[model samples]
Target chain A: MSRRGLLIILSSPSGAGKSTLAGRLRQWDDTLQFSVSATTRAPRPGEVNGQDYYFSSVADFQDQVAAGDMLEHARVFENYYGSPKGPVKTAIESGRDVLFDIDWQGAQQIKNSDLQEHVLSIFILPPSIKELHRRLVSRGQDAPEVIEKRMQKSWDEISHWDGYDYVLVNDDLDTTEDRLKTIIAAERLRRPQQPHLVDHVRKLQSEFGDRP
Target chain B: MSRRGLLIILSSPSGAGKSTLAGRLRQWDDTLQFSVSATTRAPRPGEVNGQDYYFSSVADFQDQVAAGDMLEHARVFENYYGSPKGPVKTAIESGRDVLFDIDWQGAQQIKNSDLQEHVLSIFILPPSIKELHRRLVSRGQDAPEVIEKRMQKSWDEISHWDGYDYVLVNDDLDTTEDRLKTIIAAERLRRPQQPHLVDHVRKLQSEFGDRP
Candidate 1:
C-alpha cells in the first residue's frame, strides 16, 4: 500500500519570499504538490481555470461553505476565496504532499479544523521591517498609500509568528529556498509516513536473511 | 538584547550519515557550535584530549552526576559519558546554537529536563536497511560478526524514531545536509528568537510603519 502524504502550511507577510520558496520546493520534489484554492472572484484574462484557481460563482462558494466542503474560506476585498477540501484530501490520500501558501489567518482556520495534525506550519519573516517596506515598494505593484496599508498589515501578520511550528527569515532567496527544500524532506520522513518499513524489516528475520 | 540560541539534539543510528551532516552544518554556519561530551572511556591514542572528548575519571563523572551539573548522563559499554549543563547554558546564552550528537536515550533525558522548550530534536534514518548494512560493512573497521551486531544495535536505536520532532532520511548526503541547515535557520526565526526585533521595528513606525 502507498503511504499517505503530509500537509505543509506556509504563511508569510508580503514580500517575504513565500511564493518563491513554495515554487522552489515543488520544483525540487516531484511528490510534493500545490493546493489550488477556489475563488468567487473573477479570474483575470491570463488565468487558466484549473491551473490558476478553481473559479466558482459566489453562490457555489456559499453552497460549499454550508455543506462543509470548503476547508477554510474567507471574504477578501468583497469576494470570497477558499481552499476546497476535496482536492487536498484526494492528493494526500494518494501519496502526494500538498503545499498551502496561505496567510496566517487562513492557516489558523485550517489548523482549527479536523486536519490539524496533517498540517505542518511554517511562517516566513523578512530580515527586518525596513527591508520589508523596501521590497514592497520595489515591486511597484501598489501606490504609496496602498504600500503604507500593506506595511501596516505586515505588522499585524508578523505578530502571529510564534503560532507557527517553523519560521524562516528571508535574508536571501537562495539560502531560504535551500532551507525550504530541506524542511520538506525532513517532514516527509516522519514516522507516520513509513509505518510499513518497521514490519517489513522484521519479517526479513523469518526468511533466513544473511546474518552472523 | 541578544537572542537565545536553540539547543538542537540530533539522534540517529551509527552509520546513517548523521556525523557527516552535523559536521557540514557547523562548517556552513559559524553561529553553530558543537557540544563536546564528557566521557570516562579511555580516549584512543590519536584522539585529542579536549577536542575529541573531555576525558574524565569515573569519580569525576559520578561527582558531576551527583551535583546535577550534567544535562544528560548515561553508561554505554561499561563507560560513563555525559553532557555538562553549564557549558551548554553559557554557549546558548551567548547566541550560539549548540548541537548534541547523542543517542535517543540521552536526548530523552534532555527533553525531560527544563531544556524541553529550547530543544529541537531530529532523528535521521538511512534510506533502507540494506543500504545501512552496506554502509556499515564498507567501513571495514569491524568484522562481519561485529557489523551484524552494530546493525542490530542500529535497529534498536532507530525504533524510537517517533520521539523526535523532526525526522530526516539520509537518502542523499548533500540534500540531507541542506535539509538540516534549513531546519536550523527556520528555528532561529521563531518569535522567541526575535524579541529585540519587536521594539526595533516599532521605532520605524514614524518612517512608514502603521499597525493594521
Candidate 2:
C-alpha cells in the first residue's frame, strides 16, 4: 500500500534559517522533492534554469495563473512568482514529500487549495530580534538600510506564526531539524494520508466474522 | 515560565497490545506519570491500593464526583470507576505529562473538559482481527467464551478510532513505540504547551525596539 506524500510548507522571516533547515531536511531524506517555483524574474548569475527557479516569461507565468495551474502565486516588486501545481501533485501521488519555502500568504493559498489535507505547514522563528538582526547583518548581502527594512517586515511574518500547524523557535539548528523530522514522520502516519488503511480495516472486519 | 503537561489518552481494543505499549512508553520515559484510576470496586487479589487502583467507597467516590475532582467517571457492573482530578491537575501544572489507558468514552469526556487543548488522544488498532484473536487466546487467562465476547467488543472500540487525535495500526511493537515517542516529543513543542514562549516572544519584541 503506497502512502500519499506530504506537502511540507516551511515559512519564516528573512533571517530565521528557514532555507538552511529546508536544505538540511532534503539532505537528510534524499527522496523529498523541493518545490521549484515558477518566476518571471530573470535568473541571477550561476542560477540554473530549472533547479533554482522555473524561469518563465511574464506572459507564461500569467498563463499558468489563468489556467489554474499555479497552486499559489504572488507579485513581488513587479515580478510574479508561484508554485506549479503539476510537479507537486505528481510527487505526492508517487509517495514523495514536497517541501515548499514560501511566505504566509502562499502557505494560506496552499492550505485553502484542493490538497489542503496534504499540507503540513511549519513556521520557524528566530530566538530573538537581536539574533535575527545579527544574522541579517552577518549575511553581508543587504545594506544597513535594507536590513532595517527587512527587520521592520520581520514582525509581519512573526505575527502569522500561530497560523502554522507547528512552530519552531530556531534557537539551535540540530534540535530544530530533529523536531521537524519528527513532525514529518508523525504526519505521514495520519489516517487521511494513508488511504490503504481502508483495505486494511476491511480485511480486519472480514477476519472478525463479518463475512462468511 | 513553566510549561503545562499533556493529557495523553491511549485507547485500544483488547489484544491490541495497549497495556504492553503503555508500559514500554513509561519505561522509555520515567518522567511521564501513569494515571491511577479510582474505583468503588473491591480490590482483586494482589491489587495494591493507590497503585493498581485507588480503591474507594461509593460515598467517597460520590463525594469526589460532587467536588468536581473526577475528570471522567462511569458505572460498570454495579461499581463506579473514574480518574481522580487532583493528582492529574497537580502533575500537569508542574509540567509532568500524564498517561491514561482509558476507553473512547473517557477520552471524549477528557477532550470536552477544560484541559481539552492539553489532551493528546491516540487510538491503537491491531493489524488484523485474526491476529487479535490469536493474541487473546495466547494470553490463556480468559475462558473461550470471555475471549469471544471480547472479540465481539473489539469492533466497538475500533469504531471510535476516528475520535482520537492520532491513530496507530499496531503492526509491529517496536515501530509503534517509536511512532508514539515521536508524537509525544513533537507535541511537547506545541506553542500552547510552552508558557515560557510568552516571555520568549516578549524578549524578541523588546529587541525589536518595541520597548524603551
On lDDT, the candidate that comes out on top is 2
- Candidates' RMSD to native: 5.3, 2.8
**Per-residue alpha-carbon lDDT of candidate 1 for residues A4-84, written as tens digits (9 for 90 to 100):** 677799898888888888877877887788888999888999999887999999999999999988889899999998999
Tally clashes: model 2.
Answer: 0
Give lDDT tens digits, candidate 1, residues B1-212.
56778889999888889888888887898778889899999999899977888999999999999998898999888999899988888887778889999998999999997767788888887777777888888888788779878888888888787788777778799888877876776666555665665564455444443433
Question: Which CAPRI level is candidate 2?
Answer: medium
Candidate with best TM-score = 2
Q: Whole-model lDDT, candidate 1?
A: 0.80
> Mind giving the per-residue lDDT tens digits that candidate 2 earns over A81-141?
9999999999999899999999999999999999998999999999988788888889888
What's the lDDT for candidate 2?
Answer: 0.89
Error (Å) of candidate 1 at residue A134 is: 7.1
